[model samples]
Target chain A: MYTESNEKKLDEIISHYPVKRSAILPALYIAQDEHGHVTDDDIRYLAKRLDMRVNEVEEVVTFYSMYSRKPIGKYKLQVCRTLSCMLQGAEQITEHISHKLGCEIGGTTPDGKFTLQEVECLGYCDLAPCLQVNFDYHEKISTESVDQLIDSLK
Target chain B: MTKVLTSRFDLKGEACDIDVYLKTGGYQALAKSLKELKPEQVLDEVKKSALRGRGGAGFPTGMKWSFVPKESKRPKYVVCNADESEPGTGKDRDLMRYDPHQLIEGMVIAAYCLNAKDNYIYIRGEYWYIKEILEKAIAQAYERGYLGKNVLGSGFECNLYVHPGAGAYICGEETALLESLEGKRGHPRLKPPFPAVVGLYGGPTVVNNVETLAAVPWIIINGGEAYKALGTEKSGGTKMFTVSGHVARPGNYEVPMGYPLMKLINEDCGGIPGGRKLKAVIPGGSSVPIITAEESEKVNMDYESVGTVGSMLGSGGVIVMDETTDIFETTRNVTHFYKHESCGWCTPCREGTRWLYKVFERMHRYEGRPGDVELLDDLADKILGKSFCPLGDAAAMPVQSAIKKFREDFDRRIKHTLVQINKAAD
Candidate 1:
């Protein structure tokens, strides 16, 4: 999905680290930034450029959960449900969102508007029961807040 | 001259020999522990100090040490998690490279108290230079009888080895670290049989961070009350803040717990580089949420206090961001990291991370529909707390927190990108 320009910037970043493996993390970031997910072709491109094996790149991409092997919905919703958030009632919010969006964690909605996912620690323990919609965070979440928030979506 | 937030860094050309570390008042704690205080006494002193783990999670240190079984048949073990893979943090390399003996002495003391026979420093693969330095220290330690059979002739024999990780960030996690040390995939195992009962070849193992164990030698040397006097009530002892990013004098700044973040940045770190106005900061390492400039001002570099401002004292990595930077792009960088690093052992993490990254990409491309922000918030809420490991949670935290605190910026970036696209078309 990247243009030739995006590919060039990725190549430049790959050159910073001595070991090709060290460049993998930054390379994957750049590739994913260009393409929605890192495909086999992208891994091969990076592996070849970094002088690393394609399997190595593929192994790393598969090892990390963030690499999307398939196309995902337009919007991704990550909800925090760790000890801190759970103690703050993350379960209630989880059910409300799933029911309203008609999707479960890792399940894209039928309409393709959103895909719901549960996460561990969003690190904002202060604002428990928080969810990150795209790159934004809506904190102190509840059923009503989840509905109002979800309703605002196109 | 770099500030002495790190004992080893302070020893620049200070000497790698045991004599050098000892001259700088090394092993004084062990001397105190052996000569004056008993083993349980040393442990009690740490308990009273209220020192917590320096690893990402601020689990109480003394509390973790006490987890070692009082009665166990097999040999107890102390495994140091020196695999510092958290990006934007690099203080561990400084310590290992300079003050090798300091950590060596700390491990010996820890082994003595826990009644463990062997210790392992699980250094990351990238740190060959550090590995060599530590190996030299190990050889010197053995030659001087600081290690090996009957160490210091107290009938306490402990052997220390340096183990290198192939390359896995999850190995930084304790259970996963144990798995990697055992030469297995670094996926987290089911808890309930926590590391205390069965860990590292299925024995009573106490795994600690390099910085965590390094503090032990000093703790044993000083009375618990003496260490307690240095920091605030809940968080005691000095911590290494690896300040980077916009900070001018960025490096390791050693400050006692509860040190004000503002003062540490301004007075110690010499404020931001280029005198750029402070924007936000990742108080801990990558796993902790980002705090705004105002919130960072109210923060203290401790476990409990930093939490009050919606961030953590994670690994004591202070990453400062100036106002000119974009928060969305910053978090997008972080999300991209988690997505690339998540070891798809669990469903929530594997699928969630992929989706989150995709959405960010769309937004970056000026393809976000109206109400895209709400969709992102929804996705972050869904993926957090449901994963098998902290990786998933960490991936979601910065994205959510950055967006929550700096939604306007993301909106602006999204709007600005779209405007440019339309103008180019015209």
Candidate 2:
């Protein structure tokens, strides 16, 4: 079910740890990257691969906010809503993005092009009102800049 | 002004590149330690430096390293807690992104002291770009023979790897970090079998913060006394504070410990933008107590001085708030963060944070009852020291202190709700 390069990559990751079970996080990342999100089958497959119970793997997936069980939009717009960002007008930025996308905080667009999420601190509080499109950071963002960003992405 | 940890931040991204790092005296400490110093001697130097961990809890770094058993048969491990998830903190992100080799050299020196062969940097998953930069730097370190088998022809083997954590703030805690490293839920384990004695695949391990470990290379090069002389006696060495919110220049500033808090915000950060009055400051991250502007005037940027103002110098986040900010709304926002980040290991934290947020939400919407403020206080009191982990205390401290220092904000919501109820009765 894995590509040859991906499978080789997983093996290389597994080699970094002393025990095979310790590679579950990296392994899950690989699975999520291959498939848009991790599915039940992927969890079961990983369980067998890492010698862990299916529930164990499932628990790890659910525990972390990064791992998405369901498929996500092409661009995940995770706006930082913690104190620093909020102090710097993150609420307005979030509101503007939501209005522009025609989606709520947790919902995806009809076109499946974007998903809006109000994430806690992104550790870029120095650049208040920052966000991430997928894994890339957009720092010191403004409403107009967010409009430009969405337009550019579209 | 002492730029111990962040001297290379001005290099304009060249510090991440190894050639620049080496030219700027990056791995000199590792070379010096490998050639001349014994493992015990290295530990003694760190002890003399009086360096404290920059990761929220201000434990001494050398004391933490001494906890690992010297003769344990199990393979020793050195793990760097790069999971910089504390709200209002972003210093570690810059440290890793700007100077990856500095962290690498520090970890190698730590491993040498512990006689550990394998080390890992468990960075947060959202920091994937920084992780990529760190990986490239590690590859460069390997290429230069600073890492891998036979370091500097000393026959001591050291291997460093970067491990990414899926998004979980609880993983920043040492035991939880170890649990996450072991590929499980990031639930924190109990104390007594601290990670120092029993950690990382059942081996004696030493977990240090990114800033804490990054300071090691300098401590070794400049002599422990010199490093200790940079700061106050109790809290040695300079610290990196991510000063954000309402400031003209919001960025990380490296200053000696016990530097004046107001000076950091007013001078280094260029004060509040547009001459707005300062309302309050969360001197540490959001987890610490909120100090009023009156209280902030006397506070200094150190562990004890912040403690004197009923807050901690936690993670050196220094979240500044201007007069325009609504304390009620800000408190609600902080409560929501804990509510979401709580790992649900203990009932008080799990249920207590949820209850606090519900109350804060109602108060924020102006539907608060008269006793709601007291109830919020009572709920926070229940959860303060009664949880399985410090997450409970982290959630409760800010809410508790916010209520104490800024009671007017909470009372304002309650008063508005009372007026509406009286109008309905009339």
Candidate 3:
């Protein structure tokens, strides 16, 4: 279960649409936030609630990068590895985050506080080499800021 | 006094500045409507305003919102279709770049009216800049308590998140967008559980368009009646028409939706940059059928009107072709994009887009068999409605229409490709 504030907000958030399918993404977001990341059971719950075929829901949730199917660490670091971000040295930043976290590109840290994933385009070309941690987007990040942001998250 | 729609929400120096957005009239509409307007009243205004979805479909915004029954007890959603990967379409990118607040305001107001709290803008991966702009705006909205629980003490709390999509043309489709938003490959599902009925983690949803959401705050602030006064009957409000290809002024232009297509290409857009003879016009992106120069006088920037002129106003991405450009080659380029971007979710779109480009490529290379034109038409028709998504239609429409409208040009191009090659060899 999530915090009361999250639960209350999530319920109200889910009620805004007419169809149950609309709530899947939000529910997933909340579930991910609460349980660190999503699980098969969470998706199953989402499918049953939204009236979607479980297979249908699974295919979609698995396709997009934003939705984490597995439970991730506390700090879900999604570094932009698309064209613009890559042009700005996202590869180097990815390595730095990997080095700092002592994990692989898609691996989480030992303490389970940080999970690094190479995501496609965070849509911050102006401040290239961007990484979004939960709701906070750290823009124009260098290797040092990555460590600082990661350190602060822990 | 009324101020500009999207002034402060654009670029600040090189970064997307939330502080600048607050310095201006950003979030003012949500702030004002916190305690005043009920959800129905806002929906009613949108219904009255008759604002159509700006994301090509042109469905009525209020009607689409009303489709979600209020008593369902189902958690609802608001997904902004910002996946503008259409080749000629650049309007949404500009809107997000220049005035992200308009979209944020629109989404916030739409969420309030639709009785939904969570919203996501499924943006194109290529628009990394827009992601920065929108996320900052949402964060600012949260900081100001415009978002979060008990919004503005009105008990109309809503949370917003920015979800960017990999550049898949299919993802622009609402259902496909839901799939992509769910972290799946951007492939559309069969409708009827239409995304509004089943979307985003399988919840009752209202997947509104980016341009459509950006118009909401304006509709709410100015009153739907006032908003209705902007453009023509049915097709109201100013539209962002992106004109590319052989035009001198190849960029996004905001004119009334009812503005004459010729005038847009001529006056507002500074007609054909080099004064070259006009060949053809894809009046509304590559999805719509290409309009010939002869039919140039008839086109206007709207849904129904463009169809009357033997083409559709799909996304208002006007691509102008000059005399120097070959219709066969132009189509080859367009079809190739569709082919490359097809998600292979549906066979018709997957096969059809590939066949379309391949046939055009053959015709372009002067390697067409005798009945290639007829074959092109037949192939286009075969894939027309057989696919799961409109992408099949998007792939087939222009190719079939272009050949129908200008078969002679294709014929001539084949002759030129073949005969000219032989002549050069001699």
Give me the candidate number with maximum DockQ.
Answer: 2
Best by TM-score: 2
The digit string of per-residue lDDT tens for model 2 on B1-426 reads 668999999996799989999999989999999998999989999999999999989999999999998899799999999999999999999999999999999999999999999999999999999999999999999888999998989999999999999999999999999999999999999898988899999899999999999999999999899999999989998999999888999999999999999999998999998989999999889999999999999988988899997899999999999998888888899999999999999899999999999999888877788899999999999999999999999999988898898898888887455577688679
The weakest ten consecutive residues by lDDT in model 3 chain A span A120-129
- Give a tens-digit lDDT track for model 1, residues A5-98: 8777666544532244545654665676666667778878877777777776776666544556776677778786543345357767888888
Better of 1 and 3 by DockQ: 3
B21-47 per-residue lDDT for model 1 (tens digits): 777877676666666767788789878
Error of 2 at B339 (Å): 0.6
Better of 2 and 3 by DockQ: 2
lDDT of 3 by residue, B73-168 (tens): 567888888887565666777678777767887888888887777777877754656687787777777787878897888888798877656445
lDDT for predicted candidate 1 compared with the true structure: 0.74
Model number with the top lDDT: 2
Question: On TM-score, who's better, 2 or 3?
Answer: 2
Residues A79-143, candidate 2: write the lDDT tens digits.
99999999999999999999988999999998889999999999999998899998999999999
- Give the Å shift of residue B405 in candidate 3: 2.2
Reference-based TM-score of each model:
0.72, 0.98, 0.72
Per-candidate iRMSD: 12.2, 0.6, 7.7
DockQ of each: 0.02, 0.93, 0.08
